[model samples]
Target: MTATASPTHDAGARAALIAELKRSAPHEAAMRIGLEPPARAAEVLAEMNPAMVQDILEAIDAEARSRIAMAAPRELAAQWSRNAAYAEGTLGRLMDPPFATFRPGSTVGEAIENLKSLVRTAFVTYGYVTDPEGRLLGLVTMRDLLFNDHGTKLSEVMLKDPFALTPDLPVSDAMRLTLNRHFPVYPVKDEAGVLVGLVRGSTMFEEEAFEIAAQPGAMVGIEKEERIATPLFGSFKFRHPWLLINLITAFAAGGVVALFQGTVDKFVILATFLPVLAGQSGNTGCQALAVTVRGITLGDIPPGGASRLMAKEFLLGLLNGAVTGVLTGVAMFVLASSQDSPSAVMLGVVVCLAMMGSCAISGISGAIVPLTLKRLGADPATASSIVVTTATDVASMGLLLGLAAVLIR
Candidate 1:
């Protein structure tokens, strides 16, 4: 059971909520609970109710609706995010606008009264304390409001220059930081240091939960959230280019296979076992690649860590290669070839040698490509899959073909 199981148990209530929101504006209700409009749309959409989808869209602002449209579900809140012209992962995309802000010089009493009056309109997780020019000065939680002396300046009780996220940092990083810190909410700021609005933890978690659901086999055994708020079109853009790169690299392997065409045509016996060697080698390569890429992405691979990573992968590859190679050699010898035939001996040696070589190359290439991309300021996650798989595919094919050429010819 993955963490991404559909929110099926509460399906009925969620459906009713979606229906209610569709008839009304879900955005306003979501704001009270500290959810972005797009996130709200995703939650409602999980019910798979089209009528509710329509109603939600109708209730949201036109701009929000437009952004939601970009997501393909086109609920009203989604459109609002699009229309705001905020780039994906920006504070503008993730925050509720028109949030409350207070002057630093204001009395605690004045600030408290202001919060009380505007509580219905603005989110109260992190009250914005600003200078006259609207530059951020500090933040005040609701607890600060109750405990503070009334005569004190708003600046006194408010957190001075509270921790804030830039509009442009990746949401994944922000979410990780937020989870570790356990802040109820954090402010988002522009380069000029003006407070934009707050990003609530609930919103970040829901968005992350959805994002994790999009990857192949990324479920962590939770329910209620399946997909996350990754930029769908942007992800397509990132993924497509890598796939194209893989396509180009694939030709190298194809060329190697072409080299052994004569050998394959002469001894059809080699052809039958070729797939076994290639498939097993490919699987082993992929295992190493996956582990290395994961370690690198998670920051578990240390600074000046290439040698250590490479050594670990190499040793693992060697072990896997030796085991699989022996099994393959034994199987081929017993099933296909006679003990008296020199060709049987040659074939067995070829499989073992090829397996070892393929595993080593796969491990090395897997660690190298992702680390290189990370150094170049490219996203390691997006590029790692393409690079590692291409290396494994090319290496596996080349090893098998080269072995066939030598042993069969």
Candidate 2:
């Protein structure tokens, strides 16, 4: 015979267990608790990371996973499974199944009763009105349902010609749409215009936050999926390739310096300025790269806009380079005069010209690298810094040294 605890004791024990599991054994605890009741499991899993939830679901036995899926709300389960099937950054992965939906003919009284039931179990922001074939027609808010006559049909009261996103839309593109007017929820339809899901503003906000947060790491070759909880080996695998690439680029910069060995030997001061030139040009390239990447991500740069963007960056680079180069040239002149060098004025001219040219080239390289990579179907942010840095280093050092050899010697 088993001793049974009172309802209060059972509730307390379950809460305590859930709290402990959430802190330490999130995956295991989710699996164990998710098996108890479908609604309860969905509720618990909803609060956890979506990626982790999907991982746990995939790792569990098929039978168990199926049961949990079945136990979840119809729309919630459908959305979760659909999102799992999509690539990480697509809009499909960011949308949830429409929790509250009604047919065009549904009466106001029926819609209200349905919402009353759904509100208890899940979030109910707006009720989607669909046709008999599941094609999205319009939307009805709770306020509309409450203020209207009870016998009124949904089509008569709902907002017509609603905005909808297709499943294949990129998450970044979806974000662009939400910037102006933030709706509480936006409908998602299939390519055929059949209603499939809802994208909550809150959910989209969270995904955008994650994407923005991941960018710094992404620029340095870190995988977007990597987190503090990622395994040591996983992190190693993600990081090693970028490090090796950096080493190769560093060698290329060194080789440029090696080619100008005579210039460095004749004027050791040129070697001292090599790093200063590289630093300025490299920062200029990075600034261009950052702005270009942002423009691409936000959909601000439309088709055929790349040429204009490049031109703008190049002109800005020229202006900035001229100003900075004059300052550097003055400094070099003062240094050379202090050393009583015969070619002090010529050295200043060479340095000034080299700085201007290097900066202009760096800016162009920065703007083009990401755009080129994007055209080649690669991620714009992936390894972009490495390529930009390498280009700037080679350009700045090669120009400064080669010019010094010709003009100063």
Candidate 3:
């Protein structure tokens, strides 16, 4: 008969996995623990951060997720299933089963007696009081339990109408609501205002941080669940399609150049400056793009703020482009004068005007693209850079060559 591992050995292995999970991001933790048997993986996930548990579960596949859930404790498995009932990026997905609850009529001594056993299993923060119907009444801190008379009922000591979060509240909105509260835990209620679960402040903050951190990658078409420690094939699978999309968009810019083939054939100097114009406008657009994405992520942008943002970026771009344009104009004049092109002075004017116009339009596009995506119920950061870059390229190149074709010769 094959011998099973000793209890001590299994405990040590599980302790090590917990340590590893603590050190890795949720996605990385999923990758690391994915090789474990379902039973082992479920045990490790159970001991993880509540918010991280949801993310790790999401990062794994449906078969694996189901297997891990099956192996998990009944309470945790139920919480996972309940969490799945809510939409992504909502507080419901990151909640934990409330522990240490008591009826309002319970005495301090009775609550203390119950906590003795509760503390042995879970890290209870506060004792929640609820109605017989399961609606939240209030909560009592450990301090209240310590200072109050043993005969004191929870209703006499608990803080009334304690701040709570709604289950369906967006994580971004949750962050805003809890910014001032900072309590270790907040009660979660449903649309009917019945208490259902508790979310830890740390877990909520970590989820928000992960969402923010994933955005820069999202702008380039990388999935939020991908991590540096992800399997090579997994990373390739997540990334390859976006790159193909980028290649297709690049051809649009290439076609614009093809349209200007005659202008380039006549004045080769314009070719040298094409990249310069595109690069400058692209940088301007990226500045606007970064700000817009951050605003959306933090819920900083007010409703109908897009038009004001676009106008602000456009003006900022016009002023910045003018300052850069003077220097670019001088460079063009010198390069053209050296080449003895008859349109040297005129070429300088064209460069200056093209730079200013290209940057202004690029800025508007950058701000508008993300705002449009957000309005369409898509991620504001999803491949936004690709869209902004393509717009900048076509606009910058078109403005420069188009102006030359019209005004120069």
Q: Please name the candidate that would achieve the greatest lDDT relative to the true structure.
A: 3
Q: lDDT tens digits, residues 106-222, model 1?
A: 887887787787777434666788876667888887788788888988877888877888767666667656767888777777788876555666666665554444323321111
Once model 2 is optimally superposed onto the true structure by TM-score, how far is the C-alpha of residue 129 displaced, in angstroms?
1.8
Q: Specify the poorest-scoring 10-residue window by lDDT in model 3.
A: 19-28
Which candidate ranks first by TM-score, i.e. highest? 3
38-83: candidate 2 lDDT, tens digit per residue: 6666666565545446656666677777877887767667768887
Residue 128: error of model 3 in Å?
Answer: 0.8
Instruction: Identify the runs in model 2 with alpha carbons over 4 angstroms from their true place.
Output: 1-42, 48-71, 229-233
Q: How accurate locally, in lDDT, is each candidate?
A: 0.61, 0.81, 0.89
Model 3 lDDT per residue over 19-134, tens place: 77765656677778799999888878777666678777888889989999899877778888788788888999888888788999999999999999889878899989999887
Residue 184 in model 1: shift from native, Å?
A: 1.6
Task: Order candidates by lDDT, high to low.
Answer: 3, 2, 1
Clashes of each: 24, 0, 0
Give candidates' CA RMSD values in order: 9.5, 4.0, 2.8
